[model samples]
Target: MENSLNTLHTIAFTHRNLPVSEIGNLHIDPNDQKERLTAFQSAMNLEELMFLSTCNRVEFLFVTEDIVDHRFLHEFFNALYPKLSETQRKLFADSAEDYTGIHAVEHLFSVASSVESMVVGEREIITQVRNAFEDCRKMQLTGDTIRLVMRHTIETAKKVYTETNIARRPVSVVSLAYHKLRDLNVPLDSRILIIGAGVTNTNMSRFLRKHGFEQFHVFNRTFEKAEKLANDLNGTAHKLSDLNTFDQGFDVIITCTGAEKHIITKEIYQQLLQGETDRKIVIDIAIPQDLSPEIIAENNVTHISVEVLQEISNANLKERSKEIQHVEQIIKEALYEFDHNHKSRMVELAMRSVPEKVKEIRSNAVENVFHNELASMDSESREVVEKIMGYMEKKYMSMPMLMAKEILLKKR
Candidate 1:
């Protein structure tokens, strides 16, 4: 099992090498994940697996003994994304970055800490990591290895965020969008048209509401979802279909959805404009943006896309970069701690049967070895003898484990 621990691996396709646009192509739909990941794990003979996807990254963390060379990667992507063309499969396989053993552990800590994120200071990645683990765990796709690693990973991330200046100021896409909106001098009474009820849209809408912008109309494919977000913001809810018929003008449209193509088409924009010639604000933070490119090219719209936010993120990252050394120090300490903890757990597992074994020995001695002698003794003498032996047995059972743990701690 210790050798198996060294086989832990991570395969990452992130914004560092791949464009965010291409990253979306790797996103396995939630409905397809269980079947896809399970089959892939079985085929690869993986001991455990966890899949994590974000706007700009897709990662596969697993424990397997097979060397993840080019051939392995080709086979990996081939089995996992069978629908992809040979060319596409090869492209992904070639672009993938992999790490093994302790390096893989370090990569996860960096990711959850947000230091490896496209937006380095954003703390949302921590929650994203935790949620991803939970989702994978629910599918029974993970085991003790991932569970132990994630526990340490989350702890290191929290320490990094709290102890250092990494997440000092808000630099998330949502916060950046809000800052852009604030700079635009948009009024609180401006009609805010929210175009999805997903996590991104919910956060943006609630953020806007918290900043005293009240006028909102949320639209989602699921009316109940839109209604839920609407209720939270003291706003109105509408089905996504109603967007075509919405005659009410919107000064700002904030849209983020799971649509493969543009949710807000050119015609939808024209109808939504209500003949107003004034400039409009559209925060299209969705990957493969919710706003149509034609709308941005043709209409008088101030579009805030993910790419635009990334440019700002790069500049803000310099300030956060100063704290990387500090964060790395914490991660190093955590890595050492995890080593010690893992060894201690191994000791506990190895000695788990000691008490039962000791009890069996005591039973044999009392019933078989000393049965004749005890039969010749009085009841009071026998009772006292049994109590003394039980005391010794208990101490004998606990001594080895306690001594082992003490030695391990001393070595640490």
Candidate 2:
């Protein structure tokens, strides 16, 4: 159950590790995610690392040049969260999991496939994973190991989607939210207000549009994003600040935002409820949440958070039990691929290690030659020398990675 199960170093700190609220402390601001990654790279000096932070989880997939133990992980977290409380620190220190080698590949593949989602088969996670991968690419943080694992992860996950019904029914958070809104029995032509113009809201709008609901008012912190989404949805845009002042009341409201504080607090709810009499439903898809609990207590309004949605979705997810075994089979096959590739790569590295080291020393010697022999030379000549060294280094490291069968046959 604990992540320490693996001896090789691949780590994950997720909802399984701590409560979401506690996980909040580990939350890196989206803007600061790259900075946090840079800090991890500098501190760990790892062989390879991939960082994934989502509303439901924060995962760190890494490899060390040498085998490491629990203490190495504890110290790693300590540096990452120096300000954590004793309890918070223990949650992270004691709970972080590392699944060494192929196990790491399996875990990542599971995540990419939505086996780890609160809602079993949420599709949005696919986008989130891709975004995380692209971010690492932008920061130039992805290494050869991470690239192979992520590519396999995507492939394995997509196979699950195509080959199974696990993703069927009301399995995603967005679709579940839409189901809840429909169950409210509000009129089809009811006035609707959507707060925040992110992905969830976009999906909600498209769902509503398909259902023939055209009366929509969109609001966001930035008027432009809201206006753009509004235009896309065939609706009017309003400033998020207009929540308190808007004279007309919508029959239903949906809000999902990144704001740390409740955008629809009790006070704001009262103002929104001011002008006219109408029953309302609020679908809050935001993490850190958008609507306060008190909004649910108001007589005419229903507030549905992600937790609420999960509870409702659980009943529908039961049918997916049969599909899990198939998913497991897919994972098993991916693990096989990962193992085969990893062993071949390892053997290649092992057989060539001494030669590689000699090459490394030669590289150092060449660098010295550059400094001493080429230093006094013309700029163009020195550039040519550097280019030649680059070419040789590439050639030396470019030997084919081989599986045991291939290596054995070649030996024969």
Tens-place lDDT per residue, model 2, 1-412, is 1122242356666665565545555666566667877787778776556677666577777666645566776667776776777676667768777677667778888888888777777778877887888888788777766776778788888999999888876457778888777787778888888998877788888889889898999999889989999998789999999987876667888887766667887777777777565667878777667788676776676777766775765676577767888999999988877666655555664556645765776767767744587667898987887788767666655544334447644543
Pairs clashing in candidate 1? Answer: none
lDDT tens digits by residue: candidate 1, 96-206: 989888789999999999989888878889998999999999999998889999999999999998899889876887898899899999999999999989777898899
Q: Which stretches of candidate 2 lie over 4 Å from their true place?
A: 1-10, 13-21, 65-78, 239-245, 275-278, 297-300, 344-405, 408-412
RMSD of each: 3.1, 7.5
Residue 18, model 2: Cα distance from true site in angstroms: 4.5
User: What lDDT would each prediction earn against the true structure?
Assistant: 0.89, 0.74
- Where's the lowest-lDDT run of ten residues in candidate 2? 1-10
